[model samples]
Target: MGHDRIDPEGIADPVDDLYSQVVVSSGEKTIHVAGTTARDSDGLVVGETYAEQIEQTLTNVEASLAAAGADPADVVRQTIYALDCDAFVEEAYPHVVDFYGDDALPASALIGADSLADPDYLLELEVTAVLEE
Candidate 1:
C-alpha cells in the first residue's frame, strides 16, 4: 500500500516514542463525515447509558469508514460532542482507545452542551479520513 504518515510535533510532555506522530495519509480520496451519534443505521436512538452510546456512535463511524475502505489509521481528524463534557475522560475513553491504539490519537476538539437532540443521547463523534490510493 502506498502511503505517507502525518506527524504531529507538539507533545507538551511525555511521549513513549519521539518518532511517533498523529494521523496518517493514504489515498487521494478524502472522506468527510458529519458527527455521528448513537443513533442506529436507521437514525433511531440506541443505548441507555453514556458509555454505551459513545461506543455505539464510534462503531457507527468505524463502519462508515470501512464502507469507504478506510480504517482508524486513515482518520485525520475526530470531533466529539457530549452532553456533559467533563465526563469524557472517564466515560468515553475506552471506546476511543480502539481508534487511537498505541500511537498518538488524532487532533480532536470536544464540545460540551446543555443537552443533545434527544435527552437519551449522550455522545456523538465525527471523523475525517483519507483513503489510500
Candidate 2:
C-alpha cells in the first residue's frame, strides 16, 4: 500500500493540508462547518497580512467541506470577508483559485469588513455544501 497527499510541495509549511481539511466523507449529509477565521487550532490569529490569514482560513474550509462529503464543486454558496476590502480584492483575491480552481468557482459574495473575530483575522470564508447521495 502507498500513501497519497494533497499539494505537498506547494505549501512551504509541509504540514498535511488536511490538518485543517477533510479527506473523506459519505452518505446524504448536510454539514455546517462553522465559519473559520485565520485563527489557528490554538485560537491564535496567524498573520498580520490579509493574504496569510485568508490562505489558512480557506485551507480550513476545504478540509471542512471534504469532511462533509463535498468537494469545491459541491459548494453551492460562499462568502468572503476582508478587513480592508480593496487591498485583498486587488492583490490576494487572485489566489482564490488555489482554493477551488481559479477557473471554476461557486456562487460567492465578498464584503469589506472593519474587523473580524480578531484584528489579525484579515479574511475568512464561509461555505455551504450539499453532499450527494
Candidate 3:
C-alpha cells in the first residue's frame, strides 16, 4: 500500500482513524466513479429511511467499482452527498462503517445538499480507486 493519510493539527481527528483529512496514493491504474444512488435495476428507488438508502447506494457503488476491476479496498477517496446531513450522520454513518468495514475504509468527505436529483432520493456516493502496478 502506497497510500498516505494525513491528519493535520488543529483539525479534529476522526474517530477510529477510519478516514483521513487528506489521502495520497500512487498507482498504475485509477478509477473514477460517478455518483451512485439508491435506485435498483428496475429504476425504482430502494429504502424508506436514510439508512436504508445509504446501504443501497453503497451497494451500487461497490458494483460500479467491481465493474471497473476494483473494490472497496482499492478505493482511495470517497465523497457522500446527502439531503439531510444531520440525519445521515446520526442514522446512516453507522451503516456506512459496516458497509466499508475497518480495513477497507478510505478517505472521505460528506456534503449536505439542499436536495437530490429526486425528492425521494436521500443520498449519492462517488469514489476513486487506485490499483498499483
Candidate 4:
C-alpha cells in the first residue's frame, strides 16, 4: 500500500495537525468502517465526557479495522461527528492524535451534530483504510 499526504499550494494548510489536506492512496484492498461510537458489546454508552467517549470510540474503530485486516496506519480518511465540536477539539483532540499519530494522520473532517443515535453517545467515527494485499 502507498499513502501520500499532500497539502497543495494555493490551498492554505490546515491549522491543526489532526489531518492532511489531501490523501492519495493506492492498494489492492480497501476497507470501509461504518460509523463507530462509544458503545460497548452490551450496547450501553461508555463515557460521560468527551475525552472518555472519544477514547472508547477509537477503540471501537480499531476493533472494526482489525476485523477487516487493517490498522490505523492503513487508514486514509476519517469523518468525525461530535455532539459538541468545541469540546471535542479541546478535550478529545489529544486522544485522536495519540491514536493516529502526527505522521500517520489521514484526511479528515470533524463535524458538529445536534445529536447521535443514542442520546448518550458523544461522538462517532467513520474510517476508510487500504491494505497492500
Best by lDDT: 4
lDDT of each: 0.70, 0.63, 0.84, 0.90
**Which candidate's TM-score is highest?**
4
Query: lDDT tens digits, residues 32-92, model 4?
Result: 9999999988988898999999888999999999998998999999999998998999999
Q: What C-alpha lDDT, on a 0 to 100 scale, does residue 132 get in candidate 4?
A: 84
Predictions: Cα RMSD each: 3.7, 10.7, 1.9, 0.9
Better of 1 and 3 by TM-score: 3
Cα lDDT over the full model 2: 0.63
Query: Over all chains combined, what TM-score does candidate 2 have?
Result: 0.70
- The TM-score of candidate 1 is 0.77
Clashing pairs in 1: 27-131, 27-132, 27-133
Model 2 alpha-carbon miss at residue 58, Å: 1.2
lDDT tens digits, residue span 76-123, model 3:
888999888788888888877777676567789899999889889988
Candidate 1 C-alpha RMSD relative to the actual structure: 3.7
Query: Model 1: runs farther than 4 Å from truth?
Result: 1-26
Better of 2 and 4 by TM-score: 4
Please give me the total number of clashing residue pairs in predicted model 1.
Answer: 3
